[model samples]
Target: MKLDVELPNPQNLTEEFEWTFPVGTVNENGDAVITSTDKSPAKVKFKDVIGSQRVTLKTKLGGRTLQESVFNVQVAYNKEVKTVYFAAKGGNIMAVKVDKNKTPEMTIKPYDMGVKSGQHPFNIFFNDSSLYVLDCGRQFTYINDETTQNMGDGKISVISYDGKKVETMLTNVGGYAFYDPFYGYLNAAEKKLYFSDRVSGFAAISLDARNQTMSRSNFPYFVQSNRLGYYGKTMMYTSLNSAFEFVDGTWWWAKINSPTGVFRFTNADILSKEATAADPEPAAGVVFKNLVIKSFVVDVNAALVHVVENSSNALYSVPLDDTILKAIAKVDDIKTYKIADLPIKAEGTSAEPVSITQLILDKETGYVYFGLCSDDETLYKSGLYQYDPVTKTLTPIVEGMGVYGVAINNAKSKLF
Candidate 1:
């Protein structure tokens, strides 16, 4: 879009001009060619358009929008918005533009899913243009007794990337809750959704599209029955904090907190016989003990898991050997890096790290992303950031607000 206006007084050009876009379209920061003189027109890059549309331009006073003068123009699409979505404080889900090389980005409230935000969107994972959010809602104060049937509002929900559709999928969250499900992962290969609970290692949800009997409240799930068998028809306790896929029916779990470490198990052994966390010979679960990890993501091809320790300044790693990945009954692999040593840049000042809340990875690019919380505004600003494992580089993509979980959405069609 180009603009040219006549000005009787050169001083009139000192006032700010604001552009009002049409409805159903989104505008990001620009690639506009600006000039002080009125003789030449200014070119402004625009946003999402289906085919062609009309727009308007307006004037501003001290950051306030004045009366708008309507105008019509044919517009086209801006197709290259690689978006980053975050589960923020106060149940807000945020979307913003980003790039691969750690480019600084900006976002506004309008970028959210056009629907009411979740209560405490603890963590999120994106797939096929939909965001799977694990919210710890109800102020994190609501605790259901052991006899309860539902996990309530503080569970999983799905939201489309463009905010066109939403579904709350927490109807049959498997009985009681010693605590809420804090983090989760979607297993597309197995057609299941798994989440980590404080008391019961974790729980599962079936996303099998072929099942006609599946409903909102009667979904079949299994928690650890005893220490050995995991296919318990009802609820039992498992003390794993988080779970991630290793390969096929095999999985890796982090400790819930007592004796910290990771656990590995396969479905063949879990359902084949009874098992317990303390079993020595015929156990369904295997432990790689002693390291405390709250959340982690597995790199299937690399044979490694990127781990985040609770309240620590470092990021640790656990490697797997192909020969004994699922074959071994016990395991041990630990590597650490001081991830907090990298300062977060804000307003031209470098801020020190305060705390890390969540962690996720982009499988397509192999880039890691996480949410950081800041207590002091001047020292640091909370927002989304990315870490390049290959380059050992950290970049603050966007800052100024606290976020709980973050996910990457490559198909950001709303702004295209």
Candidate 2:
């Protein structure tokens, strides 16, 4: 079923959009809300809405409930096996078997091999029978053949699913200490592990699956955010608000108000588009400058555009094809006019509804999901939201108490 959703004003997202929905027998409000519960099978309240069917799920079976936790959660799956995985609160990774007849749900278990407890399950990966988790700790933890009392050595834990054993890799990358929020990528084709800090520099650590040894190499560029992707033989890096591709062993980086930096690594010459090429500083600058960027996410397929909000409280995209950048390259800019806009306006909602949280996107289907909240403290107030861009629709896939995280393995017929 298609549900029309309005974009909060780009200038003011805090202001709620006055949109409503109606279904066969129920009336519902478009805004997000949270609920508190006292039972394991928690209770959720869908308050202030018109029609109930307007908030119903389109899937065949399975029910929704709130995820109770403070930290971010991640879900993984092996499409071939039709199984789903998730790291829930209290550092437990659970696997739920999916079949044609059962409801979409999960049961918890201890992997018993986490590199360290209390590590944020913010990042999860399933590559060839191994799970690579980025445990972003404020301080480093000790990880070696022995357990030590030194409680502060930031590290990445590599766990093998076969035996559920973990080993620490790469203590220091590029002379700086390690921190949480690591963007990890292992090239299945090349057998290489790439690492980068969401708030700072970039580097790579080569892993030998046989013995699990880490070798670090200093790669250039300061990445300001966490959203990045890899496809083909090329790895794309988003710096500040703009993005560049590392393909064919060459780095081609471009943006306005900053040097259009390019390097071949093999060659010593570092060329700046600003030094040799007179590039005009575009009005909608590439960088957010001094504004405090609150939240940002990239549409996996839309490489040139990203969704970001600055301290100015404005949501905008940094188009790689901005006129100024294209003018310097003496090529036609490829950016098309924006076809749609998000309906968020103002700031600081009355109890901090589910609408306040950032929407997580499914790369395969372009569906964005996020939970609703009634207030800052009661986080798991509502269930899951799936927004389809094609129909400009929003579907409340799951509903219950406030949920900590939302994960969908559509390929495996499961949601966690």
- Highest-lDDT candidate: 1
Compute each candidate's TM-score over C-alphas: 0.65, 0.42
TM-score of 2: 0.42
Segments in model 1 whose C-alpha atoms lie over 4 Å from true places:
1-81, 101-110, 139-144, 147-151, 172-181, 208-217, 223-240, 271-288, 317-336, 341-357, 376-380, 410-416
Clashes of 2: 44
Which pairs of residues clash in candidate 1, taking residues 3 or more apart in a chain or in different chains? Answer: 201-238, 227-275, 227-276, 228-275, 228-276, 229-275
Taken over the whole model, the C-alpha lDDT of each candidate is 0.53, 0.34
Worst 10 residues of 1 by lDDT: 345-354
Summarize candidate 2's per-residue lDDT along 1-416 as a digit string, tens digits. 22333333455423222222221112234334232121121222233211112222221112323232231122222223233333433434433333323234422111122233334333444556555555444432213312432333335555565325766654432223333324444455666655544333345455653333222333343332221121111112223212233433433322211222121121122223222223222223333222222233446375433322222222334444435332322111212322223333333322111122233445665655543333332323344344555664555444333322223344443222
Q: For residues 215-240, could you state the per-residue lDDT of candidate 1 as single tens digits?
A: 32354334343443432311134344
Displacement of residue 255 (Cα, Å) in model 1 is 2.0
> Which candidate achieves the best TM-score against the true structure?
1
TM-score of 1: 0.65
193: Cα error in model 2, Å = 2.7
